[model samples]
Target: MSASAPTSFDKILIANRGEIACRVIRTARDLGYRTVAVFSDADRDALHVQLADEAVCIGEATASQSYLNMTAILDAARRTGANAVHPGYGFMSENAEFARACQAAGIVFIGPPVDAIHLMGSKRLSKIAMQDAGVPCIPGYEGEEQSDEQLLKEAKRIGLPLMIKASAGGGGRGMRVVTDASDIPEQLRSARSEAKNAFGSDELILERAVMRPRHVEIQVFGDTHGNVIHLGERDCSVQRRHQKVVEEAPSPAVDDALRARMGEAAVQAAKACDYVGAGTVEFLLDDKGDFFFLEMNTRLQVEHPVTELITGLDLVAWQIRVARGETLPLTQDQVQLNGHAMEVRLYAEDPAAGFMPQTGPVLAWQPASGEGVRIDHGLRAGYRVGSHYDPMLAKIIAWGDTREDARRRLIRAVEDTHLFGVTDNRRFLAAILRHPVFAEGAATTAFIGADFADDAGMHALAPQSHHWAIAAVLLSSQSPVTTRHWRNSGPHTQRLVLLQGDTRQTVSLAVSATAGPGVLDVTVGDQQHTVRLGASNQCIDNQSIEVDGVIRQPAWHRDGTQLWLDDAGQVFSISDVTHAPPATTAGAGTGQIRAPMDGAVLDVRCAEGDQVSKGQVMVLLEAMKIEHSLTSDVDGIVASVTVRNGDQVKGKQILLSITPDAPEA
Candidate 1:
């Protein structure tokens, strides 16, 4: 029996987690709908749970045990008497089985139908449909054979540099680009395995990797009444590892004619799938604006805010409306393009450290705000950056009448953001905006990899600017400023060494007092730098500067390299020579106990001349937000410890050494 669609549901349950959950709940409540939320064991006290009108704990911390458990989510919805279920993008948003289950149980799934999802979610079937719909698609094999040898043959026919992709997944996972024949079979096998693990589908597809094509997508919406329309386009060419880090609407390159053609194709694709609710049709466009269909996201995208800003439409509210069996409220002719929009994904990763994930408590949290700036963040003032889920912490979006305005706004907003406790990529993002290539809008998927090979662009300034900036922030934020009392009233130059992990560099700066009491104008090598003092006057004053505009907390102290930053639930240290004392090889010890990796000491195990055995857990060193037990190298007594638990240790910091003493009996 087809249940009668209510004009509006009294309540809805969010079958997802994180920022999107909080985002949807806010809109739902504003629409006068009570919201129910679910959480895993680790997220019991998560911000989204607190924001919801009702909350329930589902399972453990792992994604499979909690968020992806469709039955558990549907069961929670049923138990809570929620008439509608909204899957926020990731976990089960595109799962056909989950939609079928919801329909079987009489709950409204706020997305496209199960048939639509099933038909389009399969990349193989979608390719056929798109080809049938007159959409310009790439020349590749969408054949039947699934054998490794068969796929290899097809790859040879399609030529080199082809993409081996999972037939049922997106998001750059379950995909591989093989450049040589020797790498094909292994990559094919890996792709299939990852596809199976991620989407429960080992079947794969092959496509010719387009050269320098821009990734532009159209946000499309459709209802059961067969009406579908597109809302402009998003430029997602600036990516890393095939995943988008920055997105913008009103693409700088796409002209009116190109948009209209792409929009028409998107609508036809949605109609072919009988798509319902909000979705985005992804496409790859060549330099001349000729395009090919990539995939149709059956759920709302994370960068939907850009579309909202450009089109002045509330996609979430529209999603709720369409789920209630409403027809398209407007036509294609009704859409209007007003402004430029951009969104930057802030992740808990150290870009300088090969983008490794970091976890820790949030010491300071100040998101950007003002005209045309918005922050969709799940974290609060004291939230811990976790490692179990995607590393994205918040999305900072900006909107303006012009693209230049949006860029300037983003740069200013990112600079104003003050984050602590956990390491964030704020400086890196800011640097991208100020970069010459990005400023000219000349970036592609290879832009980051090419421009940042040496990271010279992101870390553009010299050591003098950085040191003075840190000192300026510290002096301004901490101690009271007094008059510059130098007897000669000349430049007071000081030489200092800066250390990051195991690397060290020496630099000298001539510090001259500026016009302001807490201001300093410093000169390094041949360039002059200016710095404003911070609030604190103690250790680094009390303020920190944004590193390269990707807001990362600075870790420098007056003593040894004993800097601390937490990631997820663990603490990580930033080691340097300033924190590492001289090796204590004075006592009975062997060769030496060298620091394994660049990290900070969480604790020291044995003291000077303590009897120790082989394979013993001697010390605890933390790096990249995870702990490693620094065990003894040989069975003997530890001679002496040169570093403390809170001290930062470099790659070769000799903590202690077991001397070659009397033979162990």
Candidate 2:
């Protein structure tokens, strides 16, 4: 490969999955490079696999056996004659060893140098490097001594409300906030466990937690020729569980002076590690406008689309060029920030349920499309959402002339988007976009937990009287007798149960068969409506339902006795319980502990006869690369343990049984 060949890749193997993979493939394809997608068993039929020129199955559903398996990925690259490898964001994106392996295997790693990744991979080491480079860093201890006692002492010295973070962790894993001194030991244990599981390291660093700070990150780019530039900053303060839910470019709080200072600091941080390609230098912007270095992400971010939109530049394309030993495309002075851009991560989790990861078929997937709206997703209708990956389903980004314009466009775009069948955070994201705090650009790290922590964001869609009538007509249309005998009966009443969130409503429908096959006169409550089904405008398997003269293309799907509808923006799940079997008491409030979702049991904290207290963690379930502690609901003695560590269990499957303690005499 010549040094002048800036974009000289015949084929590139994407060593990741989901939307990021698809994003990279789109850029690679546009650059006239053949893309090879690697997938696990669960993602064999995923959008990324289908979009690539060729695809190879790396391993099983587990990330360790697939995306993160360095040996398997190298082998796949070799087998497919892939000349370059693109680790898109997650998995092995920042793994220095993986980059070294790629170099040893003679494949181009489209990222930073191995030395850079190694130095910045550890938060402690990176902080030291930044301090030495004269960058503003958070006041903390990043010593090599990492014993439990030392950590506790450091936590004390750092004062209350300190943070314990894994030295080699990112993406909010291996991180914990300790507001009380007594909780340090337990938080340390949990943080270390997660760190070891996530980054293969248990070493920790202590820092004083900056309260109510805004998370602002600068997008930096570098090349092998010693050129680096910052593309302004993005405010990612709208977060949940320490992970960013919404991100926007040209932070509302950052003025021109602040932007220059933060951008210069970010560029210095990048230069300290001799960084290359796309990287983000995150900072905690305090109330007084003082910013401290948080960490550096040495890979493309999931929210890269916002930067791309605002700058009108393709970051993936830049990564490819930089990997080929190219010079920087533009200098710092040449980099210009354009209009305001914002993005929201649409996740496959129920925000009302503590953001628990959900797995089910995507019955209907209709992404928003318009002039300013950009939807980056890797989902399709009928796509099965497994528990072995992140819960993020898609990202909706909108760009406009101003921040308010962008915010309004994004809210409308989110409302226009729809994803059915699985419990998702669409409504939750819409609520966030419309929240007063968010709209005012005053969202801090505690925005979600403080403002919309409960189901306030999940307000139920008020069911109109005509909606019930439409439901009745649709229900009756499903019956064979109603279609055959159009003008027979005067009116027939039917009862159906529909569940939305925690509220269950029994809807009574009186339909007249004389109205004809395509139309029905239905009475729901005291109101009556003439509902009609329009001519099937089949876009894939979805159809349009014309009710009372209004034509609505409702994205809908049916599976057995369940029907899901996405009318306008509200997603309604209707189930027919007319002839359903009586509810069984087999698992009714039994002290049996069930798995929260499909996951592999990482460890069982209690034995069969072990006595446990209420809220004591009995088992640790690992799913989507995150560990979930299954706690006991009541104080009891473990009666039976049915699952062992490493056992793969389905959602709601019994893992253990706890017999409640007998009343003390």
- Model 2, 165-252: lDDT tens per residue? 9998877888988888888899999999989987789999999999899999999998877788998899999987788999999899
| Candidate 2 TM-score over all chains jointly | 0.91
Lowest lDDT block of 10, candidate 2: 534-543
Give all TM-scores, in the order shown: 0.76, 0.91
Model 1 spans with C-alpha error above 4 angstroms: 1-8, 455-665
Off by over 4 Å in 2: 1-7, 458-467, 483-485, 494-505, 511-530, 536-553, 605-618, 631-641, 656-665
Candidate 1 on 7-38: residue-level lDDT in tens?
A: 45678999988899999999999999999999
CA lDDT scores, all candidates in order: 0.74, 0.83
The best candidate in terms of TM-score: 2
Which candidate should be chosen as best, given lDDT against the real structure? 2
Sequence-dependent TM-score of model 1: 0.76
